[model samples]
Target: MKNLNPMEVELKLALAPAGPAALTQHPHLASYPARKQSLTNTYFDTPQGDLAKARIALRLRQVDGQVLQTVKTAGQGGGGLSQRQEWEWQVPDHELDLVALADLLPFQGQLSSVLHALAPQLSTDFTRRSWQLTDGLVNPGAIGQRSHIELVLDEGEIISGGYRTPIREAELELKDGDPEALWALALTLSEQVPLRPSDSSKASRGNALSNQHWPLPEAHSPAEWLHRATLALDAYHDSQQASFLSDAQQALATLADHPALDADARVYAQALPGGLDAHGQPSTAYGNAALALAHRLAYQTELR
Candidate 1:
């Protein structure tokens, strides 16, 4: 295991079936070398879901036959960008290493009592193809000065009981430099690939599958509306359910008239209807609009 920042800042994007090929062939990423890995990750929680109730995720991942334990707290901000506190360590096998975790968790005995009863609830098996991008090369005088990022495309499935949800997404993690650069890079790549900013993580998706419950987002403001619309778009793509598309249309309509919406953002929201109408069909225009919506939502600060 290598040293990593305790704070994890990353952007997750929902990808179309052809998104992988489009991104890999993009001019900015084509010349760079890439690496592939097979990962199996199992998530743990108490029988009563104590850890999930507390918005904590405990996972054991097998990478190249080496096992790693990771714990992540509930993060803030969605639609594209999120920040959370994470702790990871290497363990001998696929078991909880309480001794190592004891030094990292904030409350000792309170959580430890439940940790002892934890069991595997769900797992994700996937293949990841990744690339490392450095400053001054990809963006050439881009904003935020210099930036470093790890871009990965993940494909696989989330399995729990008899249900399995397919996984096709891309992630961009800030290795070093300005966080603003993430949105910039995503925007440039999204122009060619069909991408939608996502708030759903593998753990959340598995949990949702286990319980068979899909909830809708509540929106009161422009920023919240954007969040609702983007999540709806992704959900529609995943299930091809008409209700999700209706939800997206409603949210977009609200955002189109909201007083707080930026002039530039309103244009994206207005253009989304054409893409939404073409849902369940194949068209890059729909993806371009979805990506544009995500980009605008990521920069909204009114929620604060």
Candidate 2:
């Protein structure tokens, strides 16, 4: 995709069944007023799903009587920490101008041909209520402590070909402050709410519903697990309920809790390294220890 705009960085967290309610009751979010809206969004792709192959998602959304088109490029980081390219334009009517969108994200040699091939593949409808935090009362001296964070609670469903997938997730977006502000808020919210670290997006779930198939994620190796933990920790500061954290911790545990890994954890624990907070304990750095151990644990009812 051509550089139509700057990267959009959003932190998406999965909520337990009661997660939305917890967010609403959280003192910080509760203090802020909420803005609510119902959104109906349709995703478009070619008959062969070429856009999906390109790792791009095209969406047309109607919110409060106005229609807008958005194009989001491939994910740049793990789910917990997401950065991708995005472009949006107002739609005057029912038409989705492929030629115009192609200019923003060129695909193949004949961009026009590709654009003309797109068709509606999946859609989602949901109500979103969001709160913005700007006051520094939460943390007066932390990094990006004075920045703004927009937290959203979405409750809806993804519908395609008579199939439906429920959507209930909380999203954290940095408005105009330091990146650290995002994590600080997330940590505070997670402390009160049952937030699960998640990376799935509505577009992805919609695509799965449309195809009548879900993408099965491959299990990561010990090293890869460690890498995921690293990303999650870096992005959200080892907050809480990160799914990858358990496996990562087990993997590190396999190598004598690995002397090196343990040393790294010690360093992480004892030092407030630049760009990190006190929350990065790397406790999950001690996951299944090894791939074999993880597989074994998956089968045994009890670790013993």
Candidate 3:
């Protein structure tokens, strides 16, 4: 297998239960054969939640009878888009290899204390169907663009002790070129299937399940409302109920004049109501707009 880049950039979308079927049958993807894999991912952390507190994740993934250990750090960006540092290597078995992990991580000194306490906390079992797109193949309109992306649909369950939650989401990883291609493909896909940008990763969701609570963010201002809207979009996907969708719609409605929203983003935001609709479906318009606003907010906030 080929090694991935140490810096991982991806856009995650929360898919409806029926999304895989719709996505696969879509005209653009219907002809291409999907590469499928059964993946079992086990997440590890210390009994005292030290790794969680440090915003680090350790995982052992079993696929094709091979075991790969990976370590990830929380980097930046939100609203279903993120960039993070990751290190992965083949390991002997389903065991924690602190020595190997230490070789890959930058903070070796910090590992001495927490290494012994590390143990498996949760696992996600899923089937991944994926396709690769290059240049303007995914976007004929933007011919000669230098962009390579891998689009995947994952379906399965997150297992934590006695608790379990379904996993139905799409991920677009930027293998090469501009990250904007991710949004472009997502926008195209969302036109046919409802999609909500996911702020929660499987690791975060597992921790939430282990703790039995998902704390909601208070939306007091434009930036906060933008965050809340993204959360509501994800929650609605999980529940498929009207209340959560309503909250998302309401939150998005208040962000037109948000200082962080640029002209293009504002236009998308304005178009959101028509896409968000009352059917509890979040469109690609909503996804890209949320991401754009979030990026702008981060950029402006950093300058202050």
Candidate 4:
């Protein structure tokens, strides 16, 4: 994408409301009532020589049950690699007041303001493009899978090169109206699957060491640390080199006591199996961060 024109820059700046309430109140938000949750996300532009126009984002969310979850994801194009950060707040359902919570939600004014600010900065037409996709298979209190597919255009035609990363995502929400139940589900899901490595780290995919660069803050939360460590472990395991399993297992064991990570991290660490991938790997774009996390947790049984 070319540098955004002055008008685009102005549009993006004009859209900034600086808070989640602003987005909730917007008229368009009414369509997202199920998303009664709220979050503040910040995106970054990668360095100029970057292979992909990587975007790093941090999200702080307040969910319907008053529980809070913070998540971060980074994507770099050329190497098909991405990083993720996640944390959760353990708010009890009894402590939440649904009515008061709704009252606290933002209205349309904020959304409009934010959009106005972002409009000018966008190289792509906001009105014409589909910004968010909500359609997906709802696993309801278990897991949710959503896939987003977009055609990359090159000179007015679809580009045929290998996808640095696959664009599909499957999420496991772990919700149950009770915080404990939510935690349980998160843990259970984590054990059944293997976390997929980022695209950049995979030799068959792309090189994360490519030109793209993002200024990342040191992850301090237990959940964030676990999430990132898991990604690194996935990369190491994918290499099929046996030197790192013991170290990775040790690192995973240390996270057993992390307060932010639900019980699932510990369960996964305990059950993980040790073995090489008997089947060949899939394309780089095969798994997204969330899917990778779930897979990692689930496939740990094979680690032993």
Candidate 5:
């Protein structure tokens, strides 16, 4: 697998404090034993953030006693699904091998210069408990086609300037199954735990800390917040039809009630009468933020 640049396709779900406990008790997960590990990742970039300028992330991760360096190239990610190009290498020690990275990056011959200017930026420290799941005998999906999935529960925080943002999240990666199976598992898990789709990656979030800015979606840009919010809303509706009406309304209300979103909600309110929900939920609020909001939230999410 290391011979190829894998397309990292996965979904991230933000969870409440009780999610890990509930998820551990899930029947499907309970059917198998879980593998647990603590991961400490240190991200690196040039002083002025050269790698980030091109949406590339370089990291060294220490798990147990082994060290591995990873380089990730940005790609489309939203609505809980992410697809990125990633290169990983096993190293004897905690260090970046610029010569190895040059073989993959489009840095011409300047890869060394890039590394010379790089330094540790920020870190994501978390405990990950993972289960190897299979679409088993009683599940509706075909067990033959939906072969395997890696269900990971992560709990910890992103630290910067001695401040920490708690992280309680889960990810379902299709290791040997139809990508669609990931959604099915997500839907099943959401029933037991409160979840919101995550649009940003851990690396991206850590980068934000280096800049001394907290990337609160609502606080920074309502328009972008609206876009990401709508994506999460759509996915949630797709996840469970039983609570669509109530949940969608609540999600819309969250956007409208936020001080940052209220003004934009009003401004875009009139032009989008057609987009309003039939249940009379504020369609203008979501429509305006979704259709017209700037992509600033994305920029901030990426940490450039």
Candidate 6:
């Protein structure tokens, strides 16, 4: 994509599913919500004066459950100090329904006026567009620590994929809503994506493998098990090769209890170190001992 001036590019907006419509229109804000409509401004700075790479956004909602507007700034690369602003207003719930939020006319005049006022600092010929897609999913886990995933599909391209957290067990992202699109992408990328081993199917088994709580298993939930197995494999790798003593010990503990090891436990157990060195660090002897333990664990299931 050619870089446009951030100031000149038009804002893109979409209303995502926030929650049940009933939850958004809770009675608490009814009386005062009408008075809250206005252009709320936020600002940021960079020594290079480039606002295009910096992100800016706005959300508008009525006292009732109606969302009036949603806006996002474009990040076209430009060299120099620049500023991007977003303007939004709440739509009255009594006057419009949820679908009205996606209508282009409601804010067309306002958007024009704002764009005109900033025209000297921005480029003209910009226009607004909208598209719809199914809502994304939140990772099923604890409160205050939820993970989210979003997928975008255009034409025949698979635009994006990745984990929401640094240490999540498994994450799957499908860009297009079409089942065939997803299937084709999966087939094309099969070798690039890691496939889980079949034997470790129980969710409860993960608890015995690592310190982290693993999600319960349900039909078609191999991702979680694969995640646990990966972590167990990581710990085993660390125990055998990491330089830090604490890391090695922790890895050893994880490996010793991992449910995946069938015949390897005995060999691993025989490799663990006898004691710490004079410097209060694990000695080479300890590393050897840990290795022995790991080998035994890898080879013998009864040791677990």
What TM-score goes with each of the models? 0.90, 0.72, 0.84, 0.29, 0.70, 0.17
Q: How does each model score on lDDT?
A: 0.77, 0.59, 0.76, 0.28, 0.62, 0.27
Cα lDDT tens digits, model 1, 1-304, are 5236778889888877788888889899878998999999999988888877787888999998899999888778776778888888889988888777766654375776775788999999999999999875435676557788999999999997568878889999888887777877877787888777778778877776777665777999766887787777666655567898888888878877888767887776676656644554324565556556665666556444
lDDT by residue (97-182, candidate 4, tens digit) is: 22322222121223222221221110111111112322221122444443322111111101112222221212222222222232
Question: Candidate 5 — which pairs collide?
Answer: none
Which number leads on TM-score? Answer: 1
Instruction: Return the candidate ranking by lDDT, descending.
Output: 1, 3, 5, 2, 4, 6
Best by lDDT: 1
- Residues 142-248 of candidate 2 have per-residue lDDT tens digits of 65346777778999988876767677778877767665566556666666665544555677666655664443333344333433444343223212434434433
Error of 4 at 118 (Å): 21
Instruction: Estimate the lDDT of model 2.
Output: 0.59
Tell me the spans in candidate 4 whose CA falls farther than 4 Å from its real position. 1-137, 140-221, 237-247, 257-269, 272-304
Rank candidates, TM-score, best first. Answer: 1, 3, 2, 5, 4, 6
lDDT tens digits by residue: candidate 6, 1-304: 1112212211111111221121224232222222212222222112222222223332333323543443434332111001233334455532322243243342344343332222111111111111222222222222443222222111110111111111111112322332222222222222222221111111112212222322222222122222233334333322332333344344444544555544544344333323333222333343233323322332243233
**Tens digits of per-residue lDDT for model 3, 187-293:** 67876776777777888778877776555688765667776777776655544556777778788787775665667667766766666655665555655555555
TM-score of candidate 3 against the unseen true structure:
0.84
Clashing pairs in 3: none
User: lDDT (0-100) at residue 210 of candidate 3?
Assistant: 77
Once model 5 is optimally superposed onto the true structure by TM-score, how far is the C-alpha of residue 141 displaced, in angstroms? Answer: 3.3
